[model samples]
Target chain A: MSWTRKHLLGLQDLSRDEIQLILDTAEPCKEIFTRPIKKLPTLRGRVMVNLFYEPSTRTRTSFELAGKWMSVDVINISTNLSSVAKGESLKDTAKTIEALGADFVVIRHYAAGSAKLLAETVQVSVINAGDGAHEHPTQALLDLFTIRDKKGSIEGLHVAIVGDILHSRVARSNIWGLTKMGAKVTVIGPPTLIPQEIEQMGAEVSYDLDEVIPHVDVINMLRIQKERQVAGLFPSLREYSVLYGLNRRRLDQARDDVLVIHPGPTNLGVEITSEVAEDPRASIDEQVTNGVAVRMAVLYLLSGGKDIP
Target chain B: MSLLIKGGRVIDPAGGIDAPADILIEGGQIIGVGTDLPAAKEELPAQGLVVVPGFIDLHVHLREPGYEYKETIASGTRAAARGGFTSVVCMPNTNPPVDNKAVVEFILAEGARNGAVRVYPIGAITKGRRGEELTEMADLAAAGVVAFSDDGNTIMNAVVMRRALEYGKMLDLPLSVHCEDVNLAGQGLMNEGRTSTLLGLPGQTRAAENVIIARDVELARLTGGRVHFAHVSTKEGVELVRRAKKLGLRVSAEATPHHLTLTDELVATYDPNTKVSPPLRTREDVEALRAGLLDGTIDCVATDHAPHSRDDKEVEYSHAAWGMVGLETAWPVIYTHLVLTGCLSLIQAIDLFTRKPAELFNLPGGRIAAGQPADLVLFDPKKNQRVTEELLVGKSKNSPFIGQELQGWPVYTIVGGQARWVDEIGR
Candidate 1:
């Protein structure tokens, strides 16, 4: 199918076919990374802007690399060092970016629906990097790519997303993407950390990680913010690690072929242990590598580039 | 000047009248109500219309004495007049809140000077609404406050709330409480449910409101103080209030038109206008609220007519201010959604807006009989109008109902026998 959508706001609104098209396009994009030069002229002369309202090291850098590899001019505007620090509104900042002639705007804002707001205000194609706890479309896309790459197919795979499900944009987007692609997904976290009525989104809920581990083909662990302990969502780091952390003992109970994945900057001893992270079955590093390819697929499609090289 | 309101279905629930009648007004009072006895010096043609006692909104934020950029007493009262409300009790959450006698007098004076309709100020329960020390309730009541509240800030301290309720009982004024456990509702932007999960916005659980409602009802029973729950939005909250009434406690509750009609599913649009305190709940909650209104478990329909500046609502949903401008849209929305949908009869709905609210707060001007104040609204129930920016007379236009076509808009709002607002287009 020809690309028609101008923005990638969330996985919830995308049709199954649209998601498949994105994943299918990522196949060729992934091949370019193994080449010596790792560059493409398909999107040459296109301008993209990374407008991040929150501090980020990974998603922003991944988008930057995606734009650079595609020969697109990329500009980074961290809010702390820009007009936003002087109290400029999001609308004004988006308009300023549009007036500067950027063709694509990748936004990571601290407020939910900020990316949608920017898309409504500008004529440029917008990609949601992450918007509060709302959605991180690209992160979910890369995750889907990594899963498909490792397991050969996403259909019929039982994936368990464990940890801080209520506050994790990564978890929400993955649930939408995974469910639409015909995966049986289960979200496991403390009852307080799991959002209410999430089963309506086509996911099963569980509190015990070990019980769910034996039945799943993939385990996507979300980072637990230390502030959550202070806010009283959970008791303590030691207690959380004991209850939900993916350590060697829990890994032993999982399927032998089970792939453990994490959206990086993991709390080492909190959600996942050093042994499990370094397990050959763990695809954490490979997920980061797939992130750039998925973003490239997004950038190319949004810019109306078809006939993937 | 003596005036005659000619031939209309006058629904006066307070007087047990619902029939075609002509009202004769003289000296700012209804002198006669029956078949026309004689023509007067002035006449208003009200044929093919339904005339009722003007609406009484128990909760509104005039945003005066401070945040005038959002709404001044002048603009808010004008909007109330256009919405068919003749009397509105303004909440005390404005800057330099109405916690003292001086602030109460200032609001009353400002309302008298610039208001198009009567505006009654509600004094704060705490000084600055800090939920710390209790305000001098007796002094504020003496200064002409119709009630007491610390709306927009729930009294999180049960001890302080109980003390305030004690003082309220002594003063014989109901404390209108905005109930929500702050810690339980932390950083939540919308109702916690399927919609919030799908949208990925932080969800404010219904338990947050229910827990406080449960606490405050016990406190009301303990102190024998009259408690008025503002904008009760959850099913369990409605049930709690129902139980409170069954126990014969001096407790009352109101549901806003938005909460009674809209649901949390609308938040999918990510419109900041839909953001409200106690957020729009599920369809089941809306049904419960409608049931409460029918069974008289909920005392009245309040507008909770909060107004905010455009800048306050034109941003991200999480960053946007809570509340929508309700005064100008309350009647049309309720009329179209509730009355036309058969959830309520015309007279029953009018009673909810008029006599019920007046009786709860013990305010004047909710009846239409000889010697009663001539406050009335005339509207064609069959008429249709789309809510738009131009249709909103309030200074702020943060209404979620904008662009919605609604029937039964008020055409002429007569306050104290004078026409405060007239719809030239409808006429």
Candidate 2:
């Protein structure tokens, strides 16, 4: 029922039960994470690299800390400054990483199947950190861990993944983890940003966030829907917030126990209000804690808790 | 069951017949297609039905076995059903590929077991669709392969393609090359045009597609072999094919439904649905495709019905895959754009959807004839409506023509005398 070592990929279809297993596993790992001289032999002498082509400070740092706590050597490759920036193909970059004797690669490329591409090319294990908004398996697993630690189980959670879902690898990841964990999810956003087929993965599709917020146990807001403005996608950010954003008033309308979350570098006052993020009941910090633990489990499992070959 | 298709303008282009035909079907065969020869025991009475031959698509990517999330043989053949096609030549792009006899047999077995529509597996011209070396064509054709194509990718080496054509001539099978010179298509998101410039993304030029067509046609002449280009989009490609036919080169081309209606103007929208391979061309090129479709220079209108999951499609324009879910929209859009524009008659236009493609690819079952398998479609052309995701039947919904009002809609799709999908009462 628990994750031994499966790389997190797209959350397009992970059920609530499956997500709960990772979450439950993360709770004990969280205790292991918070202790002084936080290090474990579970993954000693194993190596991992966080190759992020896209900037995800919260995700990148959490995975790094997780690997470090697991006593695994972790290297952070900023895709912006690496050979990737120098026009190296993903396969070439993967081969280089593999050649470095790294056992696991946590990649965040800007192409949907970049992780799969890297995984296919490399002999080493590949954990999709976030691939071109394709999937962010670790993020979703951590989100599940947080919810399960706070609420005890994900099965009856009534989770809502709202905003910029079409562009957020995090949304895709969480969908796989949360749905498999047994939570009934409702994806809330403009029809344009929320793709048409998420419901097939067992989530309810909603255009009006106001209608679904009251019924949700957790409201996870993706980054405010990004726009180049000329792509004919989103019109106004101010208007997007008006229709779907979770604010202080909006939170009050929900069940008092309902949790609010932002994957972070929060768009404050856009996807959510400062007040809601700062709320004592908000299990947001716990998610960061769970993120490290979940990633440790991932690294340990992907590396098989062993020394280099 | 006996049937009398009562007040319908039956257009059999192959039979050189165009008039009201009260067709009769019995024992799974079209016993009477023209004016009534004998009274039938069971008369459904097709009152004003545009009964043409059951359609066959020359090109379709029924991604089965490996990439089933996109489309399976069962789902893809179902999509063919919705498109009013009774037979679909499944491209050789399956997981293990229909490149050899064993793969061909497996595909045929799966199609026979699950496909509502007749599925003819097209063997790969090369092993694993890598286009490095040609497959054993004589063996594949013996295994009942309809044709040969490295559909998803082109035969990059002209020498390899010319050899493929030469081998195909020996087997009498056409080497259907997906013509795209990687050099021209490199770093391209959509077509090289105002839209790509506006989007600030790399653009794939028509030269990417055109140069290959011209080179291949010349090669076809040199080799004295047949070459059929799959999904021709560029004007130069069509013009080359047109001239090659005139120059006594045994060459043919199939234009997809998207190329006829959608211009590269759509990629301007930056929606992934508008993003397609040989990326929808300029307005001038679209007009050329439409004109070619009418004049019969373009042999058949095929649906390069590529289905991608939501996650697969919901990305930046440059990063997203180049295809759209076109099975459901192909007929409606073709009806709205070509048929309504005086470009073709209802009879001639329906041929592109039905019999013409069958004749082009040498596939049987395009027409509902005596002793023929009962592959037919019952359509209601007057029902015009906008295409919404809600109405789509396929597993994925990534279409660009969601809001446009389309005139021609298939109400009841019947393949092999079996009703696969029937429209609701209100529809």
Candidate 3:
């Protein structure tokens, strides 16, 4: 299958075939990491810029590594190091990057629809690293790749996304991606943390995480911010950990083959306990490795590189 | 100089007159309104047009005394004239907001010097609209402010709001309020609902506006003062105002044309022009507002004609400023959406724009009769016009109606016996 999209803004509008093609391409992309020389000359002449308005570690590092592994030039610009601190608008910053001959812009902004704005402003391809609570397409693609690698196929699988679904771009992207691939997604979170009309997005909402733990094929836990507690989303972190935390006791109730995943910087003993984070069923580390592979697939496809090696 | 407006279907809702008539004007006042009126020195032929009282908008932001780049009284009033408005009560949200008698007098003087239409300033309810200390309401009223408001900033302090309402009762001036509890509206860029969830933009709940409306209605009942809601955009807000009116409280509300016509679903396009405070609500809320307007729960339709520059709007959805330019598009949009759709009769629509707002504020000239001000509009309901940036007389072209085709444009907007804005193409 051929890839034709100019920008990877979100997973919501992506067709099942387009998503499968990315997953299918990422299979070969993952093999390069195991080789003695982990580099490809396919995108040698391409230049990719990472423009992050919000602070992020894994998504930025993953995209940078993916670009470098493909022999592409990658330049990183965080908010403080760029003119964004001087109050330059997203449009101006994007146009400046385009003027400097950047072929791709991977943006992660705090405001929703910011990536779409950058995509509209510049001629280059855009990959949404994360835009507010909107979507993280590559992260979802990598999650899909990791889940498919373990489970063989995505169809009819029960996937539960727990934690703050209201403000989690990762959960939004996964819900769109997993559901499109025929997975039944049940979003587990506090009622305040689950946004209004989320059922319309093809996910069933459940407040009680314990009831959903045993019935799911995969559980993806989103990072819960301590500030959310300060904002009174929940009463206390101790209570939150007691209620939603995936400890050994709670993990024992799940199916033997059930996989636990997290988009990390995980607050240990908060969303998940130390024992469960290191459990054999946890695929968090593999998800990170697959993140690079999936990103490589996206960068290759968006740069018009055909014939996966 | 005297002028004669000949052969028009006059619709004076205030006077209950809807008939073909000729109106004679002398010295800026109507002298006669009947057939076979004596010919004057100057004559305007209105063959098949509908002649009605000049529109009065209760909520408009002229942006004078500061923020001239966005709009000035001169440009705003010209926009008002083009939209067939002869008088407008400007909000007090300027740079140095209209808090004192000096500012009020300054606005009145500027309006007299540069405005194409009558400009009535609304003094701030609080000093600098900070919602702390109440402004000198008596002095402001003596200085000729038509109303008082802390628009764009809700008076969050309930005690302060109560005191302001008490002063409003003593001063006999309605306090126009911009209803929003900022804490409840935290970081929200659009209405909280399915669309906001789908778009991933932070959602402002309808409770943010409704809770304050409920508060102000109780305060109005307690203080026995007139509290006018500015740009009520939710079904719950309409219901609150409707119930308040039924309880015989001195509470009134105005709905903007954008609120009545547009919905939150439009924000899915991520256009900043669609961003507004009390951010456009659901389709059900729009229907409720229309129903409210029809039933007199919503007293009148105000433009809430907020003007912003391209620099303020041409950015990310979260960073872009709220509000859209509504002055020049108000009449045609209301005409196209409400009048042509049979939701409201031509006369009912005109009454909302004319007599209702005038009577609510006790402003003069809402009807064409003997010894009345000759502020009038000649509108052609069938005339089609496309809204464009170049067509706008206002300095800023931040209107959402740009590029849409609408009908029923005002052919001529006459203020005080003189044609202030004439549609040359229509002529």
Going through the candidates in order, the fraction of native interface contacts each one reproduces equals: 0.74, 0.00, 0.78
**TM-score for model 3?**
0.98
**iRMSD (Å), candidate 1:** 0.8
Question: What local distance difference test score does each model get?
Answer: 0.92, 0.76, 0.93
Model 3, span A1-309: residue lDDT tens: 688999999999899999999998899999998999999999998999999998899999999999999999999999998788999988899989999999999999989999888888999999999999999999899999989999999999999999999999999999999999999999998899999999999999999989999999999998899999999999999988888888999999999999989989899989998889999999999999999999999998898887766
Which scores better on TM-score, 2 or 3? 3
* Model 2 misplaced stretches (Cα beyond 4 Å): A1-309, B34-41, B425-427
TM-score of 2: 0.60
TM-score of each: 0.98, 0.60, 0.98
Candidate 3: segments with Cα more than 4 A from true spot: none
Clashes of 2: 16
Model 1 native-contact share: 0.74
Better of 1 and 2 by DockQ: 1
Candidates sorted on lDDT, descending:
3, 1, 2
**TM-score of the first chain of model 1:** 0.99
Computed on C-alphas against the true complex, the DockQ of each candidate is: 0.81, 0.02, 0.83
Docking class of 3: high
Identify the superior model by lDDT, candidate 1 or candidate 2.
Answer: 1
